[model samples]
Target: MSTGKFIVIEGMEGAGKSSAIAVIESILNKQGIAYINTREPGGTPLAEALRDMVKSVEHQEKLTVETELLLMYASRSQLLANKILPALAAGKWVIGDRHDLSSRAYQGGGRGFEQSIMDTISDITLKGFRPDITLYLDIDPHIGLSRAKARGNLDRIELEQMDFFIRVHNKYRELAAQDKAIITIDAAQTMVQVHQDIEKVVIEFIAATDLD
Candidate 1:
């Protein structure tokens, strides 16, 4: 049997990543593909606990940017090692909501952390595993932030200032430019259009790689 594909959907807050993941899940189901849908910062049991800590608004005083970054990676590392890899090895497609690029953009770019520190942390946490393909949903920070605000209570990261999200969006663009496996998609489009674009990309990728 062929190895399962590792696909990731990444974006800033309220960029409709969750919606896109659902759409993709439906597509895979229709195609009769065995797949697992998951999210970073919280996938495995241990990781979910860490996610609570990371997302807690009550920890506003206690969480430093560096601490936040580390905790995110800790959760991610646990998820990848315990759940993501095992599923992939068993020939199941693994679709992730967010991945390492989020750290690079949020901590390294938005928080103004040193690139060396980000690189070191990423190297240790990720080891060598990289996503087979990443769909970067690019959206205006202003619009994204408004959507996030409407979604309800803000978490530690979601409560960050608009400027921070702008920086993160810029960084995402930079990373997308550097990585061939990353595809940038304009997310300002209507949800239906965005879903169509994502479906087209996934279908094209499968065809090109002969995944079917």
Candidate 2:
């Protein structure tokens, strides 16, 4: 079977990934593309369980940085092997809300872990698999946190210090700049503008890939 394309949307909290994904899904639907949607650290059943544990603030003791990193990858491994790869093998494009880039930003950047560790883990689990296109929503941390606050209670990771998210934002920019496939969108724009930017990228990708 022909492998399908992988598209991942990445961003800090309240960067409007959900809205961006909605636009992507609408575009793909209109294009009549077969696709599957998945989210990192919580796609498959096992991965969802891991997400709950990782995001839960009820843990009696602190969740170590190493533990957080391992759980994220464990969930990713399950999602990739069980859902993502198979969907692609069947010639279905995959839309991921978050992916390995989240680990690079959140764990490696936010937690101050070494990039070598992330590289080693990714090489072992993913064997260098990566998204064909990554749409990164860039937003200021202050604005993002304010939006997140309006939404509701914050998760464990969402409750992190401003400095952590600042690092994550910087890391996202750094990584996006290094990769031609990664497109950065100004997420601080109005919802209408954000959707417009997303549509433009999706349309361009569809045209370039020539997907039927």
Clashes per candidate, residues 3 or more apart or on different chains: 0, 0
lDDT of 2 by residue, 85-116 (tens): 99998989999999999999999989988989
- Off-target runs (Cα >4 Å) in candidate 2 are 210-212
162-211 per-residue lDDT for model 1 (tens digits): 88998999999998999999998899999989999999998888777755
| Segments in model 1 whose C-alpha atoms lie over 4 Å from true places | none
Collision count of model 1: 0
How many angstroms is residue 132 displaced in model 1 relative to the true structure, after the best TM-score fit?
Answer: 0.5
lDDT values for all models? 0.90, 0.93
How big is the positional error of residue 177 in model 2, measured in Å on the Cα after superposition? 0.8
Superposition error at 153 for model 1 (Å): 0.8
What TM-score, over all chains together, does every model reach? 0.96, 0.98
TM accuracy, model 2: 0.98
**Could you tell me how far off, in angstroms, the CA of residue 141 lies in candidate 1 after the best superposition?**
0.6
Q: What is the lDDT of residue 164 in candidate 2?
A: 93
